[model samples]
Target: MKVFKVVCICTIYVLMIMGTRPTVSLFAHELGASINHIGLITSLFSIIPLLFAIPLGKKIDHLNSKITLLLGGYLGVLGIVLPGFFPNFLGLYLSQLIAGSAQTVLILSAQDYIGRISTKKNRNQYVSWFSFGVAVGTLAGPLFSGIIADLFSFQITFLILAGIGFISCIIIHLVPNEYPIKSKKSPIPTSKTKSTFVDLLKIPSLRLALLFSALILFAKDIYLTFFPLLGLQFGYSNSTIGLLLAINGIASVIIRFYLAPITNRFGTFNVFIGSMIISCVAYIALPFFPQIVIACIIAFILGIGLGIGQPLSISLTIDNAINGRVAEALGIRLTVNRLTQVITPAIFGILANLIGLIYIFLVSSTVIALGTGIAGHNKNNRKTDVMEDSRVKSI
Candidate 1:
């Protein structure tokens, strides 16, 4: 049953993200939007989710997981289908807002479910599978959308994607309920007493994790936002751009599937550090190469870095959460990531207009290198703490 739920959620994610890149810019262009307007459209999705993540996560903690999952799928279906009918800038913005809300609910619920079902001994392995599912969907989305857009039209492709979302809804409905361990004897907290975003911010490891996640996500945002534009600048077509992005996804999926075993052997911190270093190299090399084949190769390496880094960071964050606060911790991490997604692209877009797209990759690489340094510092501090604790016990 747990596997079934995971599969269903992954399918929904693939359909949604697959259509996002293809439809968003095309929808904006169809509505006669400028590059600034396109930026607004993209930013809305992340901004809405950033604002609502904590509240929605708190809500999930008190609700039935099954219902939350079902509602999320339905919301996704509604969000996807509406844009097909409206097909204007306003419609595009509204769709993004709704889709963002749906993503918040689905992600929080799914993470909470996975956290509850798995034990500490196997938690990292389960989470890796979850991440792999996400990677698979993300990889498949653009490829499928590109094929549909080429063979038919963007509108029809969106409609088909919406249909896939509805199927995911049905799958969620059929999934067996796997509720968290709630005490039936205790009263649920009221809104004022419920866990607030401020409450979650007090944990030091979570705080560091959120900061690191944001930086990493900001770098990724720059890549996703400008890669297509870079492709165009180098005389690549829409289909070729889609294929390159697909390569990125494929690399991510391949790496994530095997990430758990590697982390198990080397430790999470080691894998995190190594992956970030590799990613830094990939981003630095990206702008120096302009050929389509070389760019794809660089993207593949970047994807591997991303795949390893994200799940390792998430596992570390979850491990560091206060007891029974895993959902809240995940929510905070996602909030920070979404916030970066919103802010980084807007800032980079302006920079792109002024300095050119090449600088975006170079600047992003520098930011990631800084994050890697922070992660390394944190790892050292952790080792020092452990050593001091052991010495005190020996005495």
Candidate 2:
């Protein structure tokens, strides 16, 4: 029941975010903003998270997570509806700022909430279900956004997105508060906060997890921010673009259904590397295929490739975290992801302007390939470290 509730809240949260972000990109384009400008606007969504994810993760360790969730939900609703009223570049930027902060809080609280309630035996399954919620939201959010924006105006679409976020807020309010409020005392010593980050980063497996997460975000951010523009360049309509995005979501949902069993069978490292290779291929294919059917095929392939990696990373981080610091570890993970989210689009935007957008896929694929190499090295180092620790203990 708890896992079910967590899935419900996360699905709704992701639905609002995934739906609104693509619309933001398309809306900015409609308002005469260039691709470069759209990328900056998209990067703005990660600004708050980039700065505060770790601290907020630490904070959630002591507070009532449900309250934090409620705050984020309502704030998200406010952010989503901002552009509906303003409908300009300024409104779009402001919405990203507010909505981004809400995103940081909602995700941190949700992951922490689920982690605290789950045990080692079931953590993978719980995180997988939580991810499943994200997948479902991803599938539905863009489809709804595209259809609504096509049928009505962007402003009306924003209003509807805000309404869905509002519903998520209500469900969050009703989610049973399973986490007990910790004493006001900090879990980690104040002086050790900086060290805590460093300590977590020192773990080879955790480092690999963060890298895997960053690579995933690199693909996701590129696709979400640019695919609409790419589709437009190919003369695809908003509805068609949304349909493609939704198809990607469908692939993610499908893979997540089998994620745990697959991970258990192949091991996380193999699955991680394999899925990334799949994404790299999809990235290479995306710009070359302008046909609707081929594009849909690419989106699904990309979805399956990207979907399995995130939950696997989450479970790895939680599994390896120091006792009572799971949320902070997740915070560290989000910090890396948000940083990727923050930098990639803006840089890709500049690259797009200089080199042309068609080649951005080649650039993204190369980056992913490099990241995969580094993560694989870290995985080997993790094995070495584990063996050495065992040898020392045996001695």
Candidate 3:
């Protein structure tokens, strides 16, 4: 129940952040940002996370999550409100950097919080709840921001979202200073922290999980960065674009409610491969359909494909982590995730400029399908090697 409460409160905080996303991209476009400029601006949002995620995670391992949660919450409000006052490219850049830093703490802390509180038996359920809440926030964020931006202005949208973020900051105090399920293992020594990164990377399963996470986030970054531009090219209004984005969220939410049963029945790895295949097809299909209804259907399919990977990845990281160092392991996951977020848009932005935007979907989908195949083949090969080693020992 406490996990649910934390998830709910944190969901509000996430709503503020997700709400700002589309507003920032579309606003930058409106401000005459070239596709390259939009990509650069979007990349700025992850710079702090890419740089600081592991260090932040190491710090969080020793501290109460409440402190970091509050810190991130207040910082997020400041970042959201900054552009409201300045209303320019300079303002957007600064807002993203600060917001990125806030997200680095918020996300790591939230994941660590739920992880520490739940036993292995219910960890999946807790993560599902957290992911489910996040889906809600994301769905609501675009819908509300789109309408407000349409009816009012981007600046007005910023101020209102900031107000909502500020309220969530107050609500965070309701979360207890500590959870009942604290780890019994001693903390890692300060000297070993450096080696922890190396040690964690040595795990084959964790390494695979990290790769999957990076791939998933990379595809997501492509969607978030390019979809609005695609919608505008189709001559859709801001409200229409927002509705389309919301449809993606709707599909994600729908899939997550069934996530536990589905993963249990079919297995996470198989589900992951299936989802990527679905996502790859969705991306390839997306470019051809400009009709609103068909586009909405593609977006929904895309959402379901993307949605399942995140929670499964989170569960995998948590299950694989060394007992005392779960937060650090998650930090590594975020570091990998943020790396893709930082690189994908900038690279694709250049590509979009050179080859045209529609073809980007095809290009990206190919990469996704290829990466999935390579990773799957390697996993199977590893299993075969282990089986052969066992056979030799038995002989």
Candidate 4:
């Protein structure tokens, strides 16, 4: 049953991602949108989620997750189908906004469900598996969309994705609800009650985790938003860009499955540090070799680094959450990540227009390196906590 649930959730996620991006710029072009308009559409997708994450998180705490999941999936289907029918810039932006909201709900509900089902001994492994599912979906979405676009039309692609989302909704509806863990009494507030976000801000480990998540996502946004445009600038066709993006997806899937167990063995902190360093190297080297083939290789390497780092960071964040606040904690992490996605691409797009794509990669690499340093500081703090715990137990 758990296996079936995970499969259903993964399928839903894939459909959502497939419908949300990949052909967005092409869609914008078809609608006669300017570059600024294209950037706004993309940024709104991330920004909507950032704004809604906390409120949705609080709602998830008290709502039935199964219902929430079903509603989110249906909303995703609506979001996908509406734009296909309209086929205009306004429709495109509206679809993304709706999709972003659905994404927030689906993700928070799924994380809450996972937190309820897994034990500490195997939680990390299960988290890795969940992340792997997302990786697989993300990997498949672009290729699937690209093929559909080539074989038929972009509108048809959206319709097909919407149909898939509907299927996922049915699948999720069929799966039995796993009841959330109940508390006998109210849990500690962590601190002042007036400011929940501020309460989260007070936890040093959570703060570091949020920062790491934001930086990693910023790097990802740089690649996702600009890479296609960069390919165009270099005279590559849409089909070629699609293939290159597919390569990135394949790299992500392979690394997530292959490196996850090794990360578990070496410690997630070490994996996080090492992956960030490799990602930094990949970004720095990206522009130096501007050949299409070389860029493809670098993109694959970047995907590998991303695949390893993301799941570990998520696991660490959830593990460090104050008791009874898993949804809130994951919400905060998602919020920070979405915020970065909102800000970074817009800034990078402007910089790309002003300077060049090379500088975009350079700036991203420097940011990731700085994040790695922060993550190391977090590692030291964790070690100190363990020592303190041990000393108290000894007494």
RMSD of each: 3.4, 2.5, 2.2, 2.8
Model 1 lDDT per residue over 218-320, tens place = 7666666677667667876666777877888889889976886887799766787777787888888988888888988998998898777777767777787
Candidate 1 off by > 4 Å = 29-32, 183-199, 385-395
Put down candidate 3 lDDT per residue, 178-290, tens digits, no spaces.
63244454333435344557667777888889978988898888888898898899998889888988899889989998988998899888999999998999999998999
| CA shift of 120, model 2, Å | 1.2
Error of 3 at 259 (Å): 1.2
Report the C-alpha displacement of residue 364, candidate 4, in angstroms: 1.5
lDDT of 1: 0.74
Worst 10 residues of 1 by lDDT: 183-192
- Report the number of the highest-lDDT candidate: 2
For candidate 4, write residues 1-395 as lDDT tens digits.
67447656765666456535767866775677655556677887777888878777766766766888887778878888877898877778888888877877887788777776778887777787888777777777776777778788888888888887777787787766766555323243554444465666677777777877887787777776777666667776666767777777778779876775786589666777777887899989876776888978988998888877777777877787765567778888889888987887667767766777667889888988887887787779888999999999999
For candidate 1, list the clashing residue pairs, or say none: 18-141
Runs in model 2 with CA error above 4 Å? 180-195, 384-395
Per-residue lDDT over 1-395 for candidate 2, one digit per residue giving the tens place of the 0 to 100 score:
87798789889888988999789989999999987888899999999888888988888877777899898999999999999999998899999999999988988889889887888888888888889999999989999999999999999999999998888888887788856434234333456344456766766678788888999989999999999999999999889999999999999999988887897799889999999999999999999989999999999999999998988888889887766677788999999999999899889998999999999989999999999998888778778988999999999
TM-score attained by model 3: 0.96
lDDT, model 2: 0.88
Error of 3 at 190 (Å): 14
Better of 1 and 3 by lDDT: 3
* Model 4's TM-score against the true structure: 0.90
Better candidate number, 2 or 3, judged by TM-score: 3
